[model samples]
Target: MKSRIHPVSRPVVFRDRAADSAFLARSTVDSAKFTEWEDGNTYPVVDVEISSESHPFYTGRARVLDTAGRVERFERRYGGAVRPLR
Candidate 1:
């Protein structure tokens, strides 16, 4: 392996505040925030909005879309002039 060419990898903590969970992993990214892990070690912490913990697919919580209501509103506004594509 070449030396002094690749980005250095360090142990960092990825925190998912929405799910109230965190995990330690090695990455090249760094953060100003720091946190203590369960293993009794302090590492740089990065706040993430979504992860496997809170994701819809992983958590099996899909968002229900209001498709029918939207279609009715569009038709009422445009007088249903927009015909369906053949």
Candidate 2:
């Protein structure tokens, strides 16, 4: 047991830049930015690149990437399934 071992969790806002969305929740994360929330109170704001709002899995827009024919190149380099020697 220790005194004040846990960080303080306060009302914080997490902003999703890609999706242009924001949400408020309790967090201990620190931020230098502040924004006036819908309730007319200023809270610490943390900007994030992606969240459930814009994530492919959450948005049901998942995509498969075949960059520069890498998969094809690999297949051509090592054709067919590889079996181990007995």
Candidate with maximal lDDT: 2
Across 1-86, the per-residue lDDT of candidate 2 in tens digits comes to 57799898999999999999999999999999999999999999999999999999999999877776996897788888765589
Separately for all candidates shown, the number of backbone clashes (residues 3 or more apart, or on different chains) is 0, 0
Residues 1-86, candidate 1: write the lDDT tens digits: 99999998999999998999998899999899898889898999999999999999899898889999998898889986777899
> Model 2: residues >4 Å from true position, as ranges?
64-81, 84-86
| Candidate-wise lDDT, in order | 0.92, 0.94
Error of 2 at 74 (Å): 9.6
- Residues forming the 10-long window of minimal summed lDDT in candidate 2: 75-84
Q: Which residue pairs come into collision in candidate 1? A: none
